[model samples]
Target: MENRSHALMTGFFTITLLIAAVLFGLWFNRDRVERVPYMLATTQPVPGLNPQAAVRYRGLDVGRVSDIDFDPKVTGQILVSLNIDPDTPITRSTFATLGYQGVTGIAFIQLDDEATGSPRLATNSTNPSRIPLRPGLFDQLEKRGKRILAQSEEAATRLNELLSPANQKVILGAFADVSATANAYRALPQQLEPVIARLPALADQAQGTLQSVSALAADATRLTRKLQAPNGPIERISGTVERVGLSLEAVGNGVELEALPHVISLTEDTRASMRALKNTMNNLNERPQSILFGAPGTPPGPGEAGFSAPTK
Candidate 1:
């Protein structure tokens, strides 16, 4: 009976061990899938990333990063394999980016769903697009601060060189010269005020002289207009003066007093000649008709009036 109990106990323990192993196996395979015939048609490597990490989408485990290896043919190109979940659908525009998860700084792939209008990305595809990761603002600011510090150090060195003894002397000398110039300029106003004050009196005197000159000019203009008046006394005086001038000019040219009798005689002779010419012309005009026909018998000479040249 004891031997029979021992056999039964041993059998029970064996069954329990098998059951435990099976449960453990089921638990382990919960996250693991059968190695399906997945293709690695394309792959992209992100720098500064670990290959053993899992690729996640919205905090869900989507794929595992398979390996990191340099391309044998393409120098400087790193190829990474990602074992994607067979159920996870990605589009042609789907891309991979690397980022740190939480505070560990361990990099992971962030798979994005881009299947809205894009075709499904084929599996086992090589040459998947690599999106460059951008540093955060704080990281950028840190880098910028380092650069600024370096520049500031350089600028300080340059400034220190410029502020050496010789440069200090030059700057101080310039300041001294500027101060002396300012002092001289400040004193000049005191010396110049009297000179500037006299200018106003000089200006007033000049203005008064100008006023007197204007008044004189106005009087001159009035006198000139008076002299030009058409029938004013000035015009008559001008005419008398002109006549006197002509008389003086004539006398200077030796017009003699004795020539007056000859001139008078010529005038009288010309008058008589003019009268005789007029009489002669009058007679010549009338004599033709009178000769052709006797004078129209109007009591011709008192003796012949009644006969009248036979009244022809």
Candidate 2:
């Protein structure tokens, strides 16, 4: 009876301790627990994704994927449901992306929002609160890798084409031409020897011509300085021109050549009349009273020969 009582006491104590541990655990994790629902729709392959996968927003645990199923009406589309904490700000702009468990290939849901002040997600008849799933960084890198691989392949193909046998033959021919050209260049110094030998004579001729030119330039400089002197040919010429101008001004002040033509005409008329009177006298001396009977001949009129013109 004593043994039975001891055993019963031990069992009772064990049961009580287990119940207390359960209660304590519930209290400690109470704030950490959450279950807010959201729906996600995706058409892309969700590799390594499954129900109960962790959902994180900016690296903090916010929820878990609760279910995944294909929509009956939409081919190639899957409907995913999540249970997130109510505090999770899953706005209208919020989206989900696949994240990995570092080398494990295990995928989780990563939520992010870029739209500002957008309304919270809501359910519709055809679609639930659709937190659109976009390709993650890994998926983008994978696509870029595929593109790079294709480009590399194309470049290698072009390179192979460029290095084909025919092209190689052409390259060899070009190399041969280059070698011939190099040999020609190597012999150029010998070919230039004769021309180089004449360089000293050519240089002497050039020096002599330069000396002559220098002498001529000195002469020209001296002549230029003489012409530019204060009392040089230019000054003499200017003085001579001034004297000539003064003489012309004096002549203009004294001479009245503009009336010379009228003076000459009057003098000719007077001289002709005088000669006529002299001739009449000579005729009358021979004929005595012929003036009364009319002289032997009439005297000459004006502008006749023997007229005395005027002088300037």
Candidate 3:
């Protein structure tokens, strides 16, 4: 009886000690932080995602997924529940996506805010605030895979058409033409050698022509300057012309003031002489012997002069 009681007491002490140790461990592992509840809803598939998956806010661990279920109210919609730290700053603009660990296919919730200044999301145990679950990288790729495949097929078809036998022949012909052009380019310098050799002579001739033109221009400029000089040949010629004009004026003045009077007197004297000569000519015509004999004596006149009546 004593041995049995001792064994029972020892077993009880050991069990109590194990129980205290377990309680201490539970106390140590208890979460003291208050966590806020959030809900995420989506119609997209969440591959490799399960309950208790880590929830991250911009790559930081902020929470854990609590439950994943289908919405009974909305058909074909999934609902994911999360318990996040209260300080995680979940807001109305916050969204969720599934991220994967490297090559492990383990999916976690990735939370991101579209706008940092969004109003805080309100939640309670009965009605948690909802975050939208958007498509992940793999989901987007999977969704676009058919279109990408179609485009790739189109590109491959175009490539095959472009590389057909006819196009290949055309490409070879173009390459041959390019080679011919390159050969022509290589021979261009030799073809231009004669013209290049003659360039120096041509340049010398052009220089000589330019020098001759310059000399001509200089001579013309000098002649123009001489012509424009104040006391040059132009001035001398102008002075001579002025003197000639003055002499002509002086001759005109002499004719008007001195020679004009003499000319008038000479004209009157000549006129009187002409009148007497005309009278003498008339008398000689009447008497032919008047030139040799003196004037006939005056005959008795009726009055006082020699006037006589002829008897018939």
TM-score order of candidates, top first:
2, 3, 1
| The candidate that achieves the highest TM-score relative to the unseen native structure | 2
Write model 3 residue lDDT over 214-292, tens digit each, in one string.
9999999999899889999999999999999999999998889988888999999999999999999999899989779
- CA deviation > 4 Å runs, candidate 1: 1-48, 51-150, 206-312
Candidate 3, residue 216: how far the Cα is off, in Å: 2.0
Off by over 4 Å in 3: 1-34, 115-117, 137-153, 231-312
- Candidate closer to the true structure by TM-score (higher is better), 1 or 2: 2
Model 3: lDDT of residue 268 = 100
Per lDDT, the best of the predicted structures is: 3
TM-score of model 1 vs. true structure: 0.41
Give the alpha carbon lDDT tens digit for every residue of 259-287 in model 1: 77789999999999999999877876877
RMSD of each: 17.6, 14.5, 17.0
Model 2 residue runs over 4 Å out of place are: 1-32, 115-128, 192-219, 241-312
The Cα local distance difference test for each model comes to 0.72, 0.88, 0.92
Please give the TM-score that candidate 3 achieves against the real structure.
0.59
Give candidate 2's error at residue 181 in angstroms: 1.9
Candidate 2 has its poorest 10 consecutive residues by lDDT at 121-130
